[model samples]
Target: MKSAFIILLAALPFAAAAQTTQAELLRRGELTGTRPSARSQARQTAPRPANTASDPVQQHLLQTDVNLAQASADQLPSLYERFIATTRDERRQWTYPQWDAAGQVLARLNQRYEQVRTTLPLEERLRVRSFQGEFHTLRGARQVKDKLD
Candidate 1:
């Protein structure tokens, strides 16, 4: 019994860590590409604020960002039809539980934005109109999963 307890305790950290990593990957969509380093993973998983409509770029990006994360998934082709139909105004409704879920999604996308932000050059960044928009669109894909569940 003692040995079993010890084994279970030993396994706890690994289990917790795996769960954390999975959540981070799902939230940030960092697991899609070739394996990323721990350093990059840490950067990509860093927490970010929920969607804020302060900047035009942020506003437009948030408007269109729905479903961006779903694109990287294997089922993307099947999901595209439904994902494209959800509008920004619908998402922005901000009801109780729905707002909570949307907040989580936006936070995840914000982390993804941080990871990719430096990759763009200044000129290209200017053209981006809040590259965060694309990230939001990707994140928006999760909305369908939510609906099905």
Candidate 2:
């Protein structure tokens, strides 16, 4: 039992990482929705003066920004779907309680991921993924070791 507990503690990170990746992707997708499109840019720049404040080029750029904002907003649901899929597919050697705890962690991660998604830069998101992966690996190993004993 002692060993099992230890193992679970260690594997927590892997579970979290898998979960976070899904969440991040979802967030990214949402953010991209509000961004501008390719064709719009070409039209905007074709006839505009380089320095004009109200130039078509500038307006297009602004539109692009708005598109990105819309995209970002759209990303969250996608993330949730992917996250759910990944978790569903991952192999679980965990006991019922361990699994339940893992589920709870996933829930917490989803909540936090959404919160962080609002303002997180790409680099920070990457870090979150790495850390979450490490956590899962450690927790998984601990759980296995305990079970074997």
Candidate 3:
């Protein structure tokens, strides 16, 4: 019975060591913790901004003039479509100078579209063609208004 008591006392330290947490062991530098998983490490690192542009059109539009001018002309139709949609929403609130600027941007975009029409993808070319037809109709209506004014 005295031998059993001595064995139990000797085993107490080992049992207490087993109950110690991984963090505690790591802090004590006695045990190396398992390396973090790739997914877990990524979560711990700096996160990307939620508002950053992800769409190609948004990326192109947000680029500086030099970068935008360097972009593939094949992307013009989509960029123009995005521009038109944005301007259309703000048209009612635009000053004359703002409208003029939009018109100048549209003209430049149209020129770029013409230059790359053949090189553009079939879908983009078709979209531009449709947009051109609608644009002309709108221009004709605007012209009549201008003549009357």
Candidate whose TM-score is highest: 3
For all predicted structures, in order, the TM-scores are: 0.28, 0.31, 0.44
Candidate 1 vs candidate 2: the TM-score winner is 2
- Per-residue alpha-carbon lDDT of candidate 3 for residues 15-108, written as tens digits (9 for 90 to 100): 5543546564333322212354464345436552332234343344324232333447656666757665665555556555654555545544
Per-residue CA lDDT of candidate 1, range 6-111, in tens?
Answer: 9677666544433435456545543332346687677647763443434333334244434433223222222222222343446545444654454444454434
Q: Which candidate achieves the best lDDT against the true structure?
A: 3
Q: Could you tell me how far off, in angstroms, the CA of residue 47 lies in candidate 1 after the best superposition?
A: 12
Model 2 Cα lDDT, one tens digit per residue, 1-149: 99999977876665554343544433432222123356534543575323222333223322221211133423434443443444444434446564445444343343335444657667656554554454455455555555555
Ranking by lDDT: 3, 2, 1
**Clashing residue pair totals per candidate (backbone < 3 A):** 13, 34, 0
Reference-based TM-score, model 3: 0.44
Stretches > 4 Å off in candidate 1 = 1-87, 91-94, 123-149
Ranking by TM-score: 3, 2, 1
Q: Which regions of candidate 3 deviate over 4 angstroms?
A: 1-68, 133-149
Task: Give residue 123's lDDT in candidate 3 (0 to 100).
Answer: 83
